[model samples]
Each structure stands twice: as C-alpha cells, then as structure tokens.
Target: MLFFLLLTIIICVLVMFYIKWVKVRSYWAERGVPFDPPNPFLGSLTFLMRKNPSLWMRDIYERHRSRYVGVWLFWRPALVVNTPELARNILVRDSGNFRNKFMTASTSDPIGSLNLLLTKDPAWTGIRKRVSLAFTSSKLKSVQAVAAAKSLDLVTRIHEEGVAEISLRTMFSDYTTDVFSAASLELDSNTTLTGEGAVRDITKEIMEFSLPRGLAWCAIFFWPDMAELFRVNFLPKKSTDFLRRILRAKFKAKSVELNKDPKTVLEILMQMMRKSQDQEKAYSEDCIMAQAAALLVGGYETTSSALTYITYLLAHSPRQQEKLYQELLVAEEKHGHHNMEGVIADCQYIDCVIKEALRMFPPMAWLDRVALHDYKVDDSLTIEAGTPVYVNGVGMQVDPEFYPDPYTFDPERFTAESIPYTYMPFGDGPRICIGKRYAMITLKNAIAAIILNFEVLPCPNSPKPAEAEIQKKGLFLMPGEDLKVKFISRK
Candidate 1:
C-alpha cells in the first residue's frame, strides 16, 4: 500500500509541473502574440519584488513598442498594449467592449464597486451619470470650499512641522486624506495639520492593497485562485471587515439625518436610491464607502506623487523654479491675491508646469481591461473573450511622438492646440476617473499654496541630485529617495 501511494504522489507532481508549464506557454504562442518565455514557477514577473531603484514602466512599455507584448503573472498570460492610438482604443473608443478591469471588486460590493472605474455595462453607466455630474467644471467650482479648507491645513502643517526635513509624501498624504474624507463624509473629521490619523483602520487597510499595480496588484488579479486555495487574502483582509462595520454604522447613524433633511452627497445618494426602482441602487453606506475608498486611494496617490515630482523637478532646476515663482507672483499680482480657482484659471505658465510634471511622471504606470467578447484589433490578431489587455500609460506619456522632446521638462506641451489621446493621467472614455476635477483641485491648490507660502530649498544632505536620480518606485512614478526640501517661509 505504501509503495503504491508513493508512486501515485510522484506521478501527481510530474503531471502538475507539466500542466503548469504547457498551459502558459501554449496559450500565447498559439495566439501568435509576441511573448517573453515564462519561468516555470514565477512566470514572467520574476523581477517583481526586487527593488529597481533604476527605471520606471517607461522602460517596460518602450521596450515592447509597436505590439502587444506577452508577460506571465504566475501561469497567467498578460498582454500590454504599447502605442498611443492602441492605448487610446483600450481606455476610450472601445472601452465598453473592454469594461471589466482586473483587481476591482467582483459582485461583492455591488453598489460600492459600481462606480465607473470598477463596474461594467449599464450599472457603471447609471452610477457614473450621478457621480460624473458632481465633477463637472461647474460642480468643481462649487466645491472650492473643500479645497480651501484642505489647503489651509496643508499650509498650516508646513508651518507647524517647522520646515524640517519632511517626507512631502507623508505630509501630502495627510492633507489629501483630510480633504477627501471631509468632502465625502460631510462630517468635520477635525484633521489637524500636525494631527495623527483621523478616520481609523478602514481607510488604512484600503490604502494597503487598493491600487497596488506591481506584484501586489497582479497577485490579486491572476493568482486569486491560489489565494482561495490557501484561504489567504490578496487584497487587504483588514479593509473588508472594517468597510463592512463602518458602512453599517454609517447607515444606522443616518436614520435621523435622512429624515431631517438631505443636503450632502451622502444624503443625495440615499435620495437617489429611494427614488430609483429599476437598477442596482447605491445605498447610503454603499455611496459613502465607495466615494471614500476611491478618494482614499486615487486622491492621495495621484496628487501626492504629482506634488512630489513637482518639488523634485523644481529643486533640481533652479532657473525653472525661479521662472515659475515669477510667473506665480505675476499671476497673484494680477488676481490681487492667491486663490486656487483663479490661480489655476488665469496662469497658463503654472498650467504648463503641472502638465509637464504629469507628462514625465504619471501617477498610474499602466492601465488594463478584460474583453467581454472576442475582439479583433486588426486582421492578423483576434483576442478571444475574457482575454486580458492593457496599455502601459507610462509609455504613452514618454513617447516623443506626442511631445516633441519627451524627456525635457517643459510645461508648454499642453497648449490649447495639443492633440487628443496623447495624455491619460486620469484615464479616458466612459471609464475616466470620476474625481479628476477633485484631484486637479487638490494638486493645483497644494502647489499654488506651497509655492506662495514657502520657497523649497535643496537639502544640505548631498550635492544637487540629477533630474534622473530623483525618479521613483511603485506603480505610480515617484521619488525614489525622500526628495527632501527646506521650507523657507516667505514673510
């Protein structure tokens, strides 16, 4: 009996190895897609966890230009689209055919994940109508209060933190979290400039795994089956429990508020739910948590990385820094004082600065989708239904075709005459980011306020770092080392 059992185990091992090896390789080669051969176990993402303090995704996307390159995420074949037109096709034009994104909540959060970024078809369209209306230029103009309050705290925090060597990453993170939480919840979260964490564990867990695009994000996408087999959580398990409790609590707490009057966004959502009968309606809890989670992840990371890069860029190029300061000063003088909307609207130079930074270091290194039905991009290649497709956004951002000199830091590339589909920092099409306006408000306001209040000085720790040395890690392009700056408050 023992001998037979041993023989059976050995046979099982051999078969498993055979199946895993053949499954990944044959899938892509059969499709005729250009692919890198996979490691039998680790697949194509062998260098996933290694700290590449070197290049960002621009290297990955450029290396595979002109074709959809195949990579393996542990036995799963993934395709990354390398060009701008093809990428625009993925994020826009044919977005409906490619609706469901990897790593988004699957039928679990229902209304919560039903926002345009995660959900699909009629459901995404419905909720997007309600939320997208809230982000229009007019609506964003109305929410200036949210930006002003958050900026006040940010400037004050810099004042209190006393201009020491601070990780602008952490500071900007707190500022954005405060703004997003207060706006989404409509409660005075009392987030102090020097204050510790304001909301609690729910948001903390939300951050850990929400938008991780490297190995962590891919882990949630391809290896969910393995996670299920091991009974392990890929996305933060901590967030799941906390989200349920906080959402339930908020729903319970809103009984009186809902009965009294409906003034806020949460109240508006509940009112919408009460009126709609046909579709999957977002409840108070669902609406609150969804917006909060979206803001918590997207709001902080996008704006923070943008701000971090801006500072790094400015610190290295003193001539550029002074030129911007003069521009801001002239704009402020014309406006009679500094206000975010006025400053952002009136100053074309500052717009250039922000746009240039976004061009070089986009927050999202890559974006993806899954085809719901078999589709053909051209006569030669036809991807079947459920095949994963992606655009390496970082590639498009750095492509010299769009921007004459992609590497040079000049903000004038976003002129009114600029062509469409060239830049996609907040994505595009029907599934573009709902909070794009809010992110702009956060980044622009923070930049304007920081420049107006303090002159960022180079750190004494080292000689001036090169423009390239200030580069980053993670799915979002960021500063690799702490881009330290001294805050000399202009009196």
Candidate 2:
C-alpha cells in the first residue's frame, strides 16, 4: 500500500510539471504572436541538436520577415525583432525600459558579474560614465599608437614565420592579444613574437568555446533562475583566479600614483578606484579587475576573428584585395608606413571592408535585453516585465531585402548608402560597445600593416566562403576551423 501511494504521488507531480510546461510554451501563441512550437526539453533550441544555434536563429529570422517573431528560450518567451523600425523603438526609443542585458550569472561568479556588460541600470550607468571619461579621443589616440606598434610587431613576426602555411586565425589572435595586453594592462605581452605568456594563455582559456561553457552561457542568458539553481559561472574559475592573481600581484608590487592624466586603461581604472570611495560611486577593486578582464576578452577573439574573415574575403575576392592594396600604398606613401594611425584613418576602402565583414558575421549574432518593466513595443504588441527580447543582428544584416545579393563579398554596398539600425557591428544606442573605438583602430592598423608587408593568398585547402567551419555552439559566432593562408612577402 505504501509503495502504491509513493508511485501515485510521483505520477501526480510529473503530470503537474507537464501541464505547467505546456502553458509556458503556449504563452506567445495566446498573445496573437507568430511562433515556432518550442521543444519539450530544450524549447526552441532543440534544433541546436542538429544545427548551429546561430544558423538556426538565422533560419528562424528568414522564416519570419514581419515585425517580430516569438521563440522560446527553454520555455521562456522571447520576441526577436525583425524590422529596423521596431528595433529602433526597442533599442533607442524605449531604451530606459530595456537597460539590463538578458544575462545573469553574477551569483555564481562575483568578479565576472561586476563588469559593465552584465550590470544593470544605475550601477551600469555610473561605471559607464566613469569609464567613458577614460576613453577620451586623445587617450584613444595614445592607444592607437600602441596598436600601430603591435601591428608592426605582427608584420615582423609573420614574415619571420617564412614559407610555412600559417593559420591566419591563430596568427591574428596573437596580434590582438599583444595589442590588448599593451593597451589595457600596460604590460608588453609579446604573444605575437614569442608565442607564449600568462596573459595570452589566460585570455585564450577564457575565450575558448567548449561544450560545457557554451551550455552554461546559454543557461545564464535563457533561464537565469535555472542557471542559478545549477550554479553556472560566466567564466571558468581557473581563468578568473589567474586574472585576479595577476592584478593582485601588480597592486602589491607598487603603490599606484594617481595621475592627473592617465595614459593606459589600467592607469585610468586605478585613478577611478582612488576616487571611488563615496558610497554612490562603486568602482570597487573587483570591478576594476573585471573591466580589465572584460576588455581583454572583448578585444582578443572578436578582432582576430574579424581580421581572419576579412583576410579570407580578400583572398577570394582578389580584385577588391588589389584595390585595397593600391589604396594602402597611396596612404603609406602619403603618411609614411610608420604613420599607421594616419594611414588607417585615410583608407576609406579599408573602413568599408571592415564594416561589410562585421555585417556578414557579427560577433555575438544577437543583442539580448530584458524588459525592465511592462513596456509597449507597438500599438499591436506589448510585452510584460522580464520578457526576453533579442535583435537578430545577423539576420538583419544578411537579409536580401536590405542588401541585394547579401551573400556576395561587396564592400561597395557599404560605400553607397547607409542603413540606419541595420549595420550594428558594435551595436546601437547608449549601451553600444565601449571598446568599439579601440577595436576599429586595432583592426585597421593590423590589416593595413599586414597588407603592406605581405600578400594574403588562399591556401590550397582553404574552405570556400559558404563552407567555412563555424562552431556549432559557442558564446561568440566565429569560424572554428584553421584558416590556412600563404603570406608572400612584399619586400
């Protein structure tokens, strides 16, 4: 009799869960919204079982070209904005109601949580204001010099690699790592030349896309409560601990002299820390470390991957490559090769190439935000508080309706007319990427330096544009395969 009673209770609980899940799944449909039926377990992401989530999201975006489309993030209803008009309303018009990003893993990892990327309104605003004061035009120019120096270093190192087929992704990764290290930490991490360092190793480990890490990130973004239940951490403990140790050691070695005019990002943060004693200004030491780590993570992989893609595009489109080479030559002769900062600023074609590459392959693929309170998107659609909303950035950029023959490698399109909210490589509105200026300078300097020093030729085994090996699941949407290329010296 006891055994039967226990079985009956277990069955009852299972039935109750099933009923709740069904109701949650149908929430969007009941609101007169078009939606794909979510999976019983993984919700709409069950398709990830067979295909890449980025591609899967793109597919959904293609299927629904109207105002918005509904999808479930593991039974959590999410609205993906398809049109620029609606996107503008969400991103800029009603920015206040959508200030917080849809990711939450702070409880699991305190240091990782303090960064501006994850923090909510008042805290984010305060940090942003204080941090923005560091990235002045003049200060960014100083960082630009560091990028130029690193670019030259990169060119010198690549040439030394000789006639060997080199992985462009790995090579660019080293260059970007060196640049970010010099800019943010004020340390010379010559990863490009030496090919090893604590900074490089730790950043690589933090950025590496693994199965467990990917799942944890997804849990944090899609279902924070579930992520909290399972104790999901934003970054690996090993990587975070290493960064903390490095920062702590630096702090212990010398008393930071508060500079009136700070040059490096680390110095700027230290200055802020000195003045952040007021309870209102919460620029804690952990917050400083988190921002530095965030900058490294943000700059490392995205710039490298972007440079690799542009290199590949140039290799396949030799006409455009030659045109860019000629442009670089003119700029070099006019400004001198050493004047890479000036050279990049003048190269209009280079700007177009980078913009086009970003449009085709956005770093994050989607910009996720949570409705802070009950918000009305349009006359027809109004979502409740805590609903997840995503901008299908990849979808918007690649849509044939926006750009004719969207798959073609044409920088000319960018040079022609500008789309308002469509070309968001660094995102849109007040919450746009803080490191965008630094990233652009680094990309331009690196690409110009490489093109001036060597001709980027396609390897025999180079994958076709459509056949590139993109990761099935990862935090960032980027190529997974080795991009082998031949570097024929211009000298």
In terms of lDDT, which candidate is strongest?
Answer: 2
- Per-residue error (Å), model 1, residue 222: 3.9
Off by over 4 Å in 1: 51-56, 106-116, 190-192, 200-217, 224-264, 272-288, 416-419, 461-475
lDDT of 1 by residue, 29-51 (tens): 88777776788887765655443
Quote model 2's TM-score: 0.96
**Candidate 1, position 328, lDDT:** 75
TM-score of each: 0.84, 0.96
The lDDT of model 2 is 0.81
How does each model score on lDDT? 0.64, 0.81
State candidate 1's TM-score: 0.84
Minimal lDDT window, size 10, model 1: 48-57
Q: Give the RMSD in angstroms, all C-alphas superposed, for model 1.
A: 4.1
Model 2 regions more than 4 Å off = 254-259, 277-281
Error of 2 at 430 (Å): 1.3
